[model samples]
Target: MTLYNNVFETVRMIEKEKLDIRTITMGISLMDCIDSSGDKSRQRIYDKITGYAQNLVKVGDQIEMEYGIPIINKRIAVTPISLIASASGEDNYLEFAKTLDKAAKEVGVNFIGGFSALVQKGFANGDRILIDSIPQALSETERVCSSVNIASTKAGINMDAVKLMGKIVKDTAYLTRDRDSLGCAKLVIFANAVDDNPFMAGAFHGVGEPEVVVNVGVSGPGVVKCAMEKVKGEPLHVVAENIKKTAFKITRAGQLIGNEVSNRLGVPFGILDLSLAPTPEIGDSVARILEEMGLEACGTHGTTAALAMLNDAVKKGGIMASSSVGGLSGAFIPVSEDEGMISAVQNGALTFDKLEAMTSVCSVGLDMIAVPGDTKESTISAIIADEAAIGVINNKTTAVRIIPVHGKDVGDTAEFGGLLGYMPIMALNKFSSEAFINRGGRIPAPIHSFKN
Candidate 1:
């Protein structure tokens, strides 16, 4: 059959080129778990999550081995903790977060997101408490993640919330200053944040979505690299076309299984997050695709252009294959999660500047990056400031998730192990932004920021 031939060709492409799927995250809404009584809230929330996700990890492992493709992470995202805290108080909200963390460990899941607040226009009592508790909650928990929506298209930019988040960023750093005090690593201040995002720290179950759903995030950096390797001298458009075709095929496979699993579990099926999520696996890297595209290295001048092309082409193909395509459907450049990127940073092929540039055009910001412990808190704030400026100006979702490895300096290796790959502490530009930060009030929204 023609389809069989296509499968064979794709397999051969995999043999020669390094291609693989990154993750298949299942988004589950927990709005129904909300309780009328404060004392019973935590128990209700935990019961709901554990019951729904009991088979999540088992199913993911089965699917991965069945297809002979690597599924890097099996993650879950739920309703924002703020809404879950409604009519409740800070004490109950923190309890709810603890429930989320405990259930994740009990079910053998890695990361559990949606401990967040949405205050685009203004803050509700629950939103305010949840946002305030972010630093303490993140500092205390190992597997919990959080994000806050401060701006959106339907609502104007919330300057007050942004200012508050800015202050909270500093406090989080100060309080948790012990573990690299990178508590802000688990928090993202967002604009136009999407619900049903399988990626963290922005993912959450939307009110409009189903009760439980499985969303697949398919990646094929190796596939793209191999395709690019063959079409070396082709025009950019031609190369992008080949990349789109590959993205379409990979997304289709994800869609197929996602639907099947959802049906089998008697749950509503969700969209396929067609992001080129990478991993520590050798042939499964977005940076490797960039390298294969003749960059020699990912942190070079041509990095952003290539990433933009790849990001766009991937969306174009994936959108056609699945009508429900959502989440951060683009290339992910998590430095500590991708082996090629870690190697590049170690070998002097990648730098902080290049990563910042790539973030402007890629899906997220400097995600999962590890920096020297000697880097000052101001320096960390500066990094957040830089990424926030990018999001504020370009109006894209840019965030900073840099880890401050305690007792590690530049060139030192920090091993998080597993999917959170090892990263060498990268050097930062020894420049002074101290005075500017000291004078921080608020970087008012851009004049053209009004998109609504």
Candidate 2:
């Protein structure tokens, strides 16, 4: 009887509250595809991805139809190209990115991640090549996404990589300026980036993951907000409890779908990422969820505390529903992706500094934010450094995915359409961090990271 009731409740959530699985990401390891010859390596990479993910879209659609649930995206994350391209002694890794894009298009997936380099401590040969190639690689490819990790709790922050990534990001913006610099939208800079994340543009198969696996990212900001509406004027504890209960139901649905997909595909189930990923659609906003918790608007004085509670309750609920809960399992506060966030920024209620504070507790950091076209590269590096410092000190994952839309400024809108959404250019500090960023050295690991 309880199971039946739960099913009915889930159906209601889907029907009226916009609950759905955000992504069904297949993580395919490409370690064995490495070859000294770049052409051979890229060919093998393309073959493996296309072969493994050929039926990904069809299977996702089938599952959606059978269960009467919506799967918003079918995507793929491969082992970071830096590792594979290094074996080929490739100076330019654009061919590898093209291969990933080709494989994704062949399989009909929306995006393919892991054109990445891990340089949290220092740059290796492959890391340098991949990092240098990111602007061209991303500019030339449609479905390929790229990331570079410049900081981690264990190894500390690599200032050199941070500085370089700033220039890379600016260059990418210029390369794709014709398209509102959409290429920067597909790039992420991370501190302690996870391997099994199903969300892009940060998803990548970790070095320790299985050869092939299925990971799912479930989202329900609308559901949570609707649940909160039912308990209006309730005590804060009661509100927290309601959010937890709603999260449990959302996560259970994700686990069910993940298990079925993994079984059908004959691949191991990786993890259920219960992130409250929002969209531009009405009612599907993380900012609205916080507003339901009593904020006049997101980025107000109480926003950070409210987000902290919301994030904690979500993790608590999701963990109980799935033992395999991993990746970024909390609320996401992407500025452009959430309608409420976009509104808040436009209304002058949300500022860049406030968003930074909110990210200290949210799942990801400084996501999908847009700045003026002429924003200095050093300033961008400073932003990455600040976000990275937070992640390293707290031992949590944090990232920066800001876009400097070329030829756009404050009060102007940068439109990308679809799930990429649109954003009103926000103001920046307008200060120079060139001296600090130019001091290229590693920041030592925090004392708390010596837990071993």
Candidate 3:
């Protein structure tokens, strides 16, 4: 009887509030596919990916149909390519990316992640090669996403990798300038990046994960916004409680779908990421949820507090709904991806600095924002360093995925159709961080991180 009641409530949420399973991501380990020969290694990588995820889309669709729920994306995350390709002795990792892209296309997944390197402490044999190849790899591949972790609460920040990534981001934008610098959209630099994240541009099968697993990212900003609207003029505690209840319902739906998909695919069920991942579509914006909390607009003075509450309430509700809550389970405020966020930026309510501050409380950092074409690499590195510092000191996951769109400036829009959305290029401070970035070394972990 309770199951039936919950199903009916879920149906209502989907029908009216735009709740959805944002992604069904299959994590596959490619550790055994390594070979001294790059070609052989890539071939095995392709085979393993295609073999494991062949029915991923089909099964996702079937589950969606049976449950009358929307599954927005089907994705695959493999073991980090740097680890798998290190044994291949590959100087350049573009072919390996192509293999992953080919496998993704063959299996009909939206994106394949793990073209990545984990250099939070320092670079290893293949880390440099993978990091160097990111620009070309992302430029040449359509369905491949890449991430590099250069900072962590435990390992401190690698300023060298941060500096190099700034140049790599600029190069990626230049290479994909014809597509509104779409290549940069597929890349992310992170501090304390999680292995079970089902979201793109950062998802990767961690070394400690199982051979294969299924993880789901659930989104319901609309649902929470609607719930908040019903309690207008209420106190802050009331608003947070409302959001927590709504998040509980949304996460219950995700756990059901994740369990069903895992059973169907004969894989272990992983975490359910209850992130308020907004899209450009109407009624699906996280910024709107913040607005519903009585803010005139997002990025206003109270925006960060509102977002902090939203993120915490969602995590609290989601954890109670499912014991296996992991990944980035909070609210995401990507500028381009959320219609309200774009509007706030265009309306002069949101600035780059404000977004940086908001990320201190939100799930991800500086996501899907566009900067001027001529933005210097040193400035970009500085932006990354700022975000990483927040993540390190606060002991949380933060990432930067800013695109310095080539040949675009403030007031000009850089468009990438569909969920990638479009955004007016944002202005950056006219300053240089060359001297600071040139001092390449580690930013030691915070004193609080010495939790013994």
Residue range 212-245, candidate 2, lDDT tens digits: 9999999999999999999999998999999999
Please give the ranking of all candidate structures by TM-score, highest first, separated by commas: 2, 3, 1
Full candidate order by lDDT, most accurate first: 2, 3, 1
Would you give me the overall lDDT of model 1? 0.76
Please tell me which predicted candidate would have the highest lDDT against the true structure: 2
Give a tens-digit lDDT track for model 3, residues 215-288: 99999999999899899998999988988999998999899999999999999999999999999988999999
lDDT of 3: 0.94
Alpha carbon deviation, residue 315, candidate 3 (Å): 0.5
lDDT of 1 by residue, 133-229 (tens): 8877887787888888776544555656765665566566556667555565677767667777777666788777787887777777777777777
**Going through the candidates in order, what is the number of backbone clashes in each?**
2, 0, 0
Give model 1's TM-score versus the native structure: 0.87
Model 2 residue pairs with clashes: none
| Candidate 2 wrongly placed segments (more than 4 Å) | 1-7
